[model samples]
Target: MAQNLMVCQFCETSNETKYKCANCDLILCEGCKIKIHTKIKKTEVHQVLDLKEFSNLSASETIRHLDLKDIQCSIHNAEHCIIYCEDCKLLLCAVCLLESHRTHNLTKIDEMYHRKVKELQELDSKLCEELPFYADLEKELKQIKSESEIKEIITKQRENIITELDRLWVPREEEISRQLKDTAEYCDALKRNKAQNEETFQSHNATAIFTASGKLDKDLPTRPANTISKQKILFSETRIPEDTKEVFGSVLTDPKCKITGSFTLNTEDSIYKIKTFENNTNILSLTKKSTIKSFELKHSKCNTTSI
Candidate 1:
């Protein structure tokens, strides 16, 4: 008689199928099944069922049991909170939702999750992209602060230098003030005398008043008190003992860092540019300090012209 036979899943040997593996859905002979279940740790957890007991699942049992109920509402003794309250911003089950958040704006949890999460993610990405520009602005501000501190120090030193230069005018002013004191006093006395002469002229004694009116004398000042020279006041012709080298090295710079002002003359020159007229800047001198020689004269273009 010819008997039915089956192949063992593990050893590929021909034998009668004795059991089926639930996880792998494989048919195995008695010897191969025992060895596969016991010999390896990987196969040890696989479920083995009897051949007759093994069958495909029913259509109703195909859907998985996920326990989708929201257990957070269990604290309030309300069952299954699936709805989201938009106005109140809370998760509520059927009973608590109807009792407390019924009047508030409401949206399903699925809708809220999709909309709010997408918006939050977009905002996060934008901030991430803009972070570098904000960082660069902060770095630039710090650099400006450092530079301003150095400039402040140089400004204070320049103020001190100006104060030292201002001392030259003190004696000049004192001399002028002293020379003018007597003249000023005499002018005040003359005004008083004129007033007295006017009073005498209006007096009841006609002869005495006439004599006083004739004696009224006028005298002009011998020299003007406001005769200080323009050169002294302007200090333009004065030569400072400190040279440009000293001024650049220590005169204007602070100890921490060196700073320079706009259009600062850093070298000595015998020539200077002066604005004599509108749209006309003329060179007053033509020599350099190092070599005190004028520019070689350009030949005259006209017969009567001078260089």
Candidate 2:
């Protein structure tokens, strides 16, 4: 098993290895150890040991032998990195140390490398612990966003309902306007006839007064019939059901209650004030003539009382 684990690093073909080169960090078979490894320039001084001796050394002893002399400085290309600056977290050559890191805390490069590796391990462990919390937070944010989108859709639906209501009421509004215009024209005709009759009454000549009075009496306009009462247009509001999910969407709570009914007071004067109570079952109204009436809605019928 030991022979299978160690392969000749120089030739990369021999599975059997009996020797190790610590300086070159290679496993060697006897043939490559003498023939190939020895032929390499400056490898003559490299420490070659027996496999048993190499296995006896500790990990620290092996690390201590690692040469950092050839590590080139990034700023000074020709210089080798000799130390590490803790404050700047950078590897520095002699020139870099003198130029910028003169007052900074410095340490051996190998020691700083081990310290940085330990810090990275700690940070990785902490990140692993916090990952689940961040994941839950992300889910909460997404849920809030989804709720906002649903609310926006509901708002758009409400606007569409209002627009449709306006469209449907156009013809009814036009009919009311036409009736008002006709009533105004009829009143204007009556006023003109009254003015003509008054001028004839104040005339000096008796013949003029007698002739104007007979013509005015024959051509006098009669009051138009009250056709508006027969063609009355009334609009009733729609009530919101207990659950609005079918029409709108899921609501947080039940909507406020509403009542729908109509009643007529026996006063010819216009209604000046109106108040409702008891969930709109009872209504109190005041007319322009200072007359008050109370109305109660029951069984789809209005019961009126004079006050």
Candidate 3:
């Protein structure tokens, strides 16, 4: 069997390589070596080597023999690049060299290509060295971002709690204020009537006392219907596990009213007047027969005695 020869670069069909053009970096068959390689423009000075000999040479040796004089200038398309300008970092033809880069540092194109390759290798090494530090910095930044998000969530929850508390309590506060005003007004009226009766009694006139007593009975203030009740608004906190995923703790409110004390009055007559004092610690009652009774709350039970 025949050995697997390298394919010709020019025709891309023949599998018999005989020569290699160092300048164009192409492998050619025997027929294409003479016909095709010669047809290309500016190949008169290109060093064509035997395929086996070219393969035997080191990479640096092959590059040294490679001709770059035929490389076209980008700006002056028809002219060929002869040198590379170190300052401008561009390939220049003769005309370009005279026009703009006359005083700039210049070198051969192959020398500059080697220098550029070395610089790229150094830059790649530096990037590899700093990659771990950048990765750690990115991780730290992400942790900070996560902490900030949690703080924002907690702050929003706090604001919502305050807003809801205000919504629930504002109307109740207004109701309490109205009850207080009404109670004050009722107390003032009673004081006026008492003052009038006391003045009448101090006059030492029996007729005046009899006439003022009927007026005082008519002017007596009635008790308010809607009295302010004692209220205790409490927030019962819920304990959360340390490992729980929840961001904040929760609270509960008891809706049912608690009965603190109870009383029983054994009165056969109808009890008309009832009054409580000192947070429901003491109570007074008056019946239609002018009978008075007093009670005191002790240990959640009521004890009464007649007066």
Candidate 4:
């Protein structure tokens, strides 16, 4: 009986038919497949095309043969050259000198292979070291972006707080000012009413027999009481009075933070205070440094004052 024969694709070994590049018509053994064909520069571009796809090409396109006769030098037309320039990828005869390569240093293909392999290995090692740095940079950038986003959100929130506080202050301030003006007008009205009563009393007294016996001065009014009653009295619900603190209502601190107002008062008993605006809460209290002097009566009557 005859033994069955099988060819190797890479080493031309007929020992086994385990691996084959059928499209390229090459027989390869396992060792030669990895060590020889796969490592070669030219065959590296050739893929393992399926037989069906390869068969679709015409015969002229499928097969490529390098004719040694065509390997003549363009300069001298010499044949059978042993030397070749791997960097330039060209054949060179003995007559071809090194000066023709310009500044390029000429070397054998085997020397180039060793040099290239060593350099490629070193470059691969260096690239491996720098890969970690690239990953670290990417991570840092992501973290920085995340922190910036958070800060932006916080800033927006602070702006909103300021806006809200401003809204609350506008109308409230207008109303308070209006009330103050109305209070002043009411005080004036009271003064006028008292003046009218005093005039009526004086007229009645003049008609009477003995109205001003004690006041001999004829310049004084017939009635004993003055024509006008000053209403200067002001009372606070809390003994702790308000301050320039009220003006601070128009003034604002960080609305996102807390607000406190400070003030000084000139009165019979001087008062100094720092108060919280939100709850009308007093933070401090103090008394006058000197005695308060009394002033002459005005067109109105009421003595105590509060601010």
Candidate 5:
């Protein structure tokens, strides 16, 4: 009814209506209502109420509305929707009310919303019952696939890990090979040096040779000139570490190059000096020599030194 509307019913001109008449079936503007209703003596006592209070009262029981200010009507773009069609399931504007949905069953948007909520609850129950079966079927399919591919997966993983390990170990293997080649070359050089030294010593024989029987060699009573006989080689002694030949006398060669001389270690100079007497009783006629030698060291961190 126009009573629920904001415009004054008497003039229908202004929307700034602040007052209305509750007893009568009429609404009035601010100026007209004040002049005719409040100030007039005869109708002054006529129980009149403001339009705001009248709006708060219930206009009708079946009448309803919806917030449709933003929703444009598809039928008329200039109009906004305020009603819903129950048969076609669409929103309707004021023009649609007169022309399109004149005979169609139209409803307020809020009532339609309640009806749709009921349908959604029924659909949700059906979904709740049907979704778990699909989920279980999906899980079964995934399990079958995983069981079939387990062997291939493990083999691929093993191959990948081994390839990575080999990649990391390549440098260490190269280092080992290089060191082995260097050691083999060094040993070959040392063997060649020893062979050369042995050849020189054998070709140029010693002139003065002493035996264990305290007898000296003579070339038919004319002795050859004595010179340095042996070349000295310095290295750590490992097989017999005791420094004294008496400790292993059982294994010593008694008559091999008999040394009829006294040997002493000169610790201050780290050298062994030997004194030889020409005759057993003549301590004055002695020959002394320091057995000192220089050698090259081929030590590396790859192995422990051994002699």
Candidate 6:
């Protein structure tokens, strides 16, 4: 009844409405809706709606579509697909298995779907467990980098100290050498002065002898000859000062700076001995003029110094 007679809600034209607008739900007639109503004063904003009703559709028949399968296989006219054959690349029914998929690998679509779902869940769990390990590894690497930076700074500081010490070392050594040379020269000058004074006294004594002989004294005057042997100046046994050596013996005698006296054997023994030291000890012994073929140093040992 709604589809047989058409009525325009805007113009009230019974059985004369043909075109209707679906958006605004307004019906329209040919003469009054378009020609007459388009010219109306206040109806310019009205749109139209088109309606269609099917008489064969019932309430129960519309709900029956819920139980029906909308999709069908083109090969089988009435069968629903639940498995896909990979070898043949086709859908198959349960009864068609022995005929078409006997020798092929058959897979259920539902099974594949569930397997994919479970795989995604396992991947998520693995990623969660690995996250903390990756973060800890990154943190350890950062700490290692920080420690290396600190070591580099310490090395640079040590290099700076070595440079400054080297600068002070050269001139100080030259001054010590100059003092030693001056002490030797002073000892030489004193010996020369003593010889000159002795010569003068001897000359006066000879003159007196000549005077006494010419005067014809009965007693002959005897003169003692001046015998003076040059005394050798001995260097200090300890290179460092006496008080300093006693106070710093433990530190200095570390065998590094100690210079021991040389010992040599007679022709029968023909042995030369050199002591071991700390700094440059191995190098010095390797090139020393000693009879021993090879030497091994034993520190913290209690005994006399041996050849």
Q: Which residue segments of model 6 deviate by more than 4 Å?
A: 1-82, 85-102, 157-307
Per-candidate TM-scores read 0.30, 0.32, 0.30, 0.26, 0.26, 0.23
Q: Candidate 6 residues 186-218, lDDT tens each?
A: 334434433432232222121221122223222
Ranking by lDDT: 3, 2, 1, 5, 6, 4
lDDT of 1 by residue, 185-279 (tens): 54455455545543442222222221342354433234442443323112122234555343422323222333433232223543443223454
lDDT of each: 0.46, 0.55, 0.57, 0.39, 0.42, 0.40
Which pairs in model 1 have colliding backbones? 81-93
2 versus 4: better TM-score goes to: 2
The CA lDDT at 129 in model 2 is 47
On a 0 to 1 TM-score scale, where does candidate 6 land against the true structure? 0.23
lDDT of 5 by residue, 1-307 (tens): 3554467776677676776554344667777786555665656534455655544412211111212233567779998777778787677889988886889988876566445434433433443444444344335434433332323323343454435434533453454444434444434443443343323222211110001011211111111133112222121223345765522111111122645454432222432432334552211111243333322222321111211
Candidate 4, residue 286: lDDT: 44
What's the alpha carbon RMSD for model 1?
A: 40.5
lDDT of 3 at 261: 63
RMSD of candidate 4 to true structure, Å = 42.8
Query: Who is ahead in TM-score, 2 or 3?
Result: 2
**Candidate 5 vs 6: which has more lDDT:** 5
Off by over 4 Å in 1: 1-71, 74-78, 148-307
Alpha-carbon lDDT of model 4: 0.39
Error of 4 at 103 (Å): 11
lDDT by residue for model 4 (1-307), tens: 6553756645555564444453255656557667777777766644444333433322212221122223456567654443456556555555665446534456653344334334433433443454444344445433433332323323343454445544644454454445434444434443443343333222211111111221112121122121111111111122223643221112132223223343333334544543444554333344643333222222443232332
Candidates by TM-score, descending order: 2, 1, 3, 4, 5, 6
Clash pairs for candidate 3: none
Residue 170, candidate 6: alpha-carbon lDDT: 39
